[model samples]
Target: MEIRLITADDADRIMPVRAYAFDATPLTPQRAEELVRYMSFRLQNTTLAAEEDGEVLASVSGIPMRQNLRGVVHPMLGVAGVVSNPLARRRGHVRTLMHDLMRRGREQGRPLSVLYPFRSGFYARLGYLGLTAAKTVTLRPEALASLLTVDLPGEVRLRRIAEGWEDVLALQDRFLGSRHGFTEFPEYRRHQPRDDDEHWLVTAHRDGRVVGALPYRITEYGGELAGGVLLHDGAIARALLLRFLAGHADQVQTITLSVPPAERPEQWSTDFAGTIASTVAIPHPAPPMVRVLDLPALTGLPAGEARVTITVVDDALLGGDWTLDGAGGALTVTPGASASEVRLTSAALSGLVYGALGPEEIVARGLGAVPAEAWDGISTLFPRADPWVYLDF
Candidate 1:
């Protein structure tokens, strides 16, 4: 089997295989043709595939994106379009294509690749571990009565989504300041509402300056008004909840919101029982798995000074001895260091770096073991900051 990168001309072959892999809504012939033309124009040369007998067996695509690692931004490949021909399953094609993609990322000094997984274990075996959580909560508007009575800081007003786009951008800039694990979706593709749905954008302003913006589409569920609010901060989240409760008290029964793992609904609501009458937390447990493409690049994330050695025991793509030195919030990760060795697999190392697990936990789970002093050093080298993506690609 031969693995190769796909150019614009190869979309005709790859898209069908991708549709099968994803089990996406079946596309009409005209829609498929339109997609082929559009994908070739948009995607260009960011796809990889494994071929046997001139037939593409498995494929994946990579988009240029970045991730916030402890208040620092690092380039990453937004991995997607992973698919294999059903007839060609279990031929190691997906694994081969992924290895090639990761190798390319490492060569470019792009240290990370993230993807929402179909199966967590499959990617876990390929040196990736869960790194983000999709926190979903459902509650009636009455549950938010607590926040409605309390005085909010900013002036809340309604506007069209396009009108509030700039305020949203400004708010995100302030919100993600010095924050770990967040990325901005550019204006060109901000996941705007589809054609049929109507949208309402609410902005919070203080001193005539936009501080926060909430944009969402209203949808009907079970013959009642319902909509899921996408948000990142606690203040804005509470304000939006209050707006929903106050404005649509009788019309809207339930308002759903997707937030980062740390922002619990109970924290803001008055009554926990009234708040979470349904599932307390609909946990989307790191649908995306993360892989460290470049050990030195990832190890170089900003932190206080510490020099530690890591020995990766499995998966040659990330296996080797790495000396990570951080001092004065600067990092220098170089090969050939003699020190207390922290031995672990590539998967375990990714898990540790991306906040999936810590050094002691990995050792306890039999994935890695470290000495007492080395454990302390590792903490200083790789500080714990939960990673989150604004949206899964």
Candidate 2:
């Protein structure tokens, strides 16, 4: 089928594809249109497709974001409505569409891409690894004690984000600066109006400066979950979290949170003590993937003066690690060689991506090998920060 970029005018055709794909899904026509409207705003990179005969079949689109700190720009492409005609289901339309979208992302210089996959394993094969997780739990506020009692970290204030867009962007930056795996908010999206959910942005200040912030709000369903952006510092993060949970106490019965893999609030939340918990890997990574996309990128990324050559086997693809010339500013990953230092597959790589296990632990578990002393250095390279998504779309 002929695949091509779509424009606002094609919504009629695109909407039907979405409806056909999500017919059994919980999404309604309005929800589908709302999503289409969101995607339409990013006309440049957005894409939609139809069969060779001109029948719409799939679509994907998203805006780009910039982290002023890193001076890097990447678009967060959201893949949606990737449905084929029922008779064309077995055809590789989905795979072909995904490849086209990924190529488009790379062509536009977006090193990182994300999407809430219809099937986890399906995306894994496409090199999209599970990075972070979110825990959705149901608990009566009265059944759980008030999560916060002590004074907040600073001149803590809660206000509606809709009142001012500048305040929302400032708070979002503060949160993303200290966390990894969290996508940066794009300038356009910052001012882009939304109506699906009401957001209350809370901030804590010390000495008249904002130290932490969280964007959240309670719903009529008698449930409240940590939403939108979140700043660094677990204590301040927890404070904002507790305040949100506390406000819903007695009236709310479930408290869900989309958190960084390393920031496990359930472990520290007095409200959740003794409560059984479940978690799903979030769309973002707990510790964002750090591939040596360019050798120069890694050289300047603070690998430290100490260095060693360790072999890593990627079961997902090629195996064997190359000589890492820290002093020479080079990395040569190769395959098939005599015995070397460490060995691990892509599955084990996931463990390292998250803080689930350290280098030493991985080696002990027969996943990989590393000098005992180098473990600290290796861990330092991958900070254990919570991964958060700036936008669900």
Candidate 3:
């Protein structure tokens, strides 16, 4: 079996496979052609793929993401899509495709490849580890009545995010910037953001200044018990819950919000009857895959720091643990740390960066260990930003 790059002409073969694999709405001929065209324009060839006999078996794409190191922004590839045809399932085609993609990404000077996986376990064998933990909670209206009854001095407004809403966008960026596990979605692509039929984007403005805001979209089934909300936090994540619930009180009896595993909303709201479900697995307990194409460049990320050494254990093929030294005038990562500052697998490192696992807990769980003094520094190096990838592509 041979895997190669996917060209625009190969859409006929690839689309059928994708439609079958996803088992969703069929990809029309025109749509497939358009998708390929868009992919060609947006992604570099290094991020393309196909399988045996020129058959488009599996595919993935990534963009060069830059990080500020010292004063420079180093590039990394944020990969998405790991689609494989059901007919080709269990054939290891996806693995081969990803491995090659990682090599190509690295060759192009991208030090790392990041992706949000459908199944954390499924990707580990390919060297991708769980970095983020998604939380899903079902909200009961009766339980939320008290929190909802509190009259807010501000007026609540609901509307689709539109052009010139710089205040809302700016407020969102400011709120999510300091947060861990979050990524900024550039303004250019907001034309058709997904809202799952019942998306609620409510903003609370007080005294003519944007203060509280929430971005929520829901999925409905036959009734309220089945349908729930997929909520992400903005400035007014907690505040908008009551009003949002009232809007859907009859339609969806329960509203669920996916949040950071560490954030405890129960403390803020009195109604805490619902159970918290983890969207992805914890401690990963799966094979972790990741590739750092350029070490010096990868270490020069813009989480902002004067100079520091961060130890990483990345076993995503061309993987190893080393002291990423950015501790001088120039940002540099060298492989000469005898003390093994922090020891964990590549998967563990991804999980750590994604805020999936706490350093202290990792040590307790036997996944890896870090000295007490080093914990604080490690946290600072890989701060949390709400690990939200704006586009699912």
Indicate which candidate wins on lDDT: 1
Lowest lDDT sum, 10 consecutive residues, model 2, at 289-298
Which whole-number lDDT from 0 to 100 does residue 45 have in model 1?
36
Q: Per-residue alpha-carbon lDDT of model 2 for 1-393, expressed as tens digits?
A: 788777777665666566666555556778777766754565544565756677765555544553211222334444444566666675777777777776665556554456666566666555454444444344455433554565555556777766644555565666565444445545555555333336776666666656666666677676555454455455755565556556666676665444443455555555464333434444322223221111222233322333444555643232355443334332222333464555554434444433345677667766566767767655654334344444554
Write the residue-wise lDDT of candidate 3 on 1-393 in tens digits.
766666645554555665564535576678766666655444433445666676666776655553222233335566665677767677777777777777777777766556666666666655555543455667665556655666665666767545324545656465445443334333333334332223446666667766655555545642453322233344254555455565555566676665554557576556557777764344232222333455545554544233234444544443454654334333345665454667775555555544455667668766566778777666655554434433233
Off by over 4 Å in 3: 7-9, 25-47, 63-76, 107-112, 148-153, 161-172, 184-190, 194-200, 206-237, 240-252, 279-294, 300-321, 325-332, 337-344, 352-393
The collision pairs in model 2 are 132-282, 133-282, 175-231, 260-386, 260-387
Query: Per-candidate TM vs. native?
Result: 0.87, 0.69, 0.69
Of 1 and 3, the candidate ahead on TM-score is 1
Over the stretch 323-384, how does candidate 1's per-residue lDDT look in tens digits? 77787777787885653367887777887677667778778877777877787777776777
Count of backbone clashes, every candidate in sequence:
1, 5, 22
Cα lDDT, all candidates:
0.68, 0.52, 0.54
- Worst-scoring 10-residue span by lDDT in model 1: 276-285
